[model samples]
Target: MKAKFLLPILIAALALGAVQAWAQAAVGAPAPSFTLTDTKGAAHALADFAGKPVVLEWTNPECPFVKKHYGAKNMQALQAKYVAQGAVWLSVCSSAPGKQGHYPADEWNRILAEQGSAATALLLDPDGQVGLAYGAKTTPHLFVIDAAGTLVYDGAIDDNPSTDSADIPGARAYVAEALDAVLAGAPVPVAQTKPYGCSVKY
Candidate 1:
């Protein structure tokens, strides 16, 4: 009887895991579209950026790993550097309501301004629809979509995983590198990597 019970439980667990795995977006596939409200209360839709290279930054203000990048201006500098070249940088907050990083829209903007964030928009994803669609797992998960709406890159912000600003200088910036390759019509050397940081509050 115990063996029979365990068999059913194992089957159920495997089925659940399969569902979750299927929910994740596959690289090289067309990115899933989303319409999210920005920190300014303006609605921003992924479809609006169809013909431009877009960067989606899954972030949380309270994550120490995220703080390491913003506190050191590493993330902001990257945003400024690329936005000047016509890239649209969209910062996404997928923290669920009552979670560690959950905050009101106004508060989100306040924090971004205080940090001098260089993103074009601060998008709110409190319901986690967008996060789930992209299979974002961490506070600083990064994704890049090319002008054709194809997901060109999905993974960590850089090679360094430590919560140390000192490591930023030596880290291989995955997003920047991927964007450069796409712009130059070259294949992305590292299309994906294990994303490291706090688990997204969702």
Candidate 2:
């Protein structure tokens, strides 16, 4: 009887996991559309950027892995580089109201200013709807959407998953590689990889 009960629970859990995976925008598939409010109380929608490439970054200011990239200026540099090239780079935060990374609008703006963030906008996703749609599971999870609204990449920021800023110099930036390929009309070399960082607070 115990074995029978355990099997059913296992099956249910697997089904849920599968559903979550399917809900995410798959590589080569149309990027899932979303509308989110920024810290400035302005609402932005994916469709607002119809003909431009978009970069989605899952960020939490308090996560150590996030700090590793930011402290190295690695993430900020990418934001500046890509956004200057006419891509929409959006930083997303999905931490719940009482969660570790959650912060009010004023504090959020202050932090972004201090970090010199260059993303087009810092979108708030406190309800986790956008994160869940993208299957964002890590503090530094990343996604790249082509100009045609196709999701070309979904995974870690770089090849190395270390929390050391020193790793930034040596690590291959998967997001940058994919965007470069997309812009050049070439196939993305590495499409996906398991993300590594603190679990997203949902």
Candidate 3:
């Protein structure tokens, strides 16, 4: 009888823990803080970009959804446009070792260079701690933090959820909109949406 009661109690506790973990980075809340190493072997803390709008892009090069954006130079263009305006664009990879998107620092540098990435930094999160803290669920999941360090947006890169670059031109770009709102000191039109992409390989 005691064992039967304990089973349900344990399950409830586990479910509650998961909910709490995800709630840590909910939109409109303070963004979760993290320190991660970039491809250049330098550490970057979320606090380092205080007072500046920050863009967190959870990416995996092997994911077709990511390829759709990069192949069309859409992601890079967004990075350039915002970074030039004082926003920090960080492309984060949370794939674990031996996973599809996992790469050594040097390799990552090469990949970014070859792809013409304009992100301020390519942060590596092999342990997935940062990803988990931010509730990153997909390869191209995106989060936008305002100058005040409040998580203003969390969702997909755009409204379309396809692997075709051609659809990009017509889809509503959510990340860009969020950045614009944050930079202009306005509320994001859409604070959250269902992100679509490959499951984060944690």
Clashes of each: 0, 0, 0
Best by TM-score: 3
For each candidate in turn, the TM-score is 0.90, 0.90, 0.92
Residue-wise C-alpha lDDT for candidate 2, range 25-138, written one tens digit per residue: 798899999999999999999999878889999999889999999998889999999888889999999897899888998899999999999999999998877887787889
Quote the RMSD, in angstroms, for model 1: 5.8
Q: Among all windows of ten consecutive residues in candidate 2, which has the lowest summed lDDT? A: 1-10
lDDT of 1 by residue, 54-103 (tens): 99999998899999999999999999988998889999998878898899
65 in model 3: Cα distance from truth in Å? Answer: 0.4
Ranking by lDDT: 3, 2, 1
Model 2 gets an lDDT of 0.88
Model 3 CA lDDT for position 115: 89
Lowest-scoring 10 consecutive residues by lDDT in candidate 3? 1-10
Model 3 residue runs over 4 Å out of place are 1-12, 15-23
> How far does residue 20 in candidate 3 sit from its true spot (Å)?
3.6
What does candidate 3 score on TM? 0.92
Clashing pairs in 2: none
Q: How much is the lDDT of residue 4 in candidate 3? A: 29
Residue 59 shift from truth in candidate 3, angstroms: 0.7
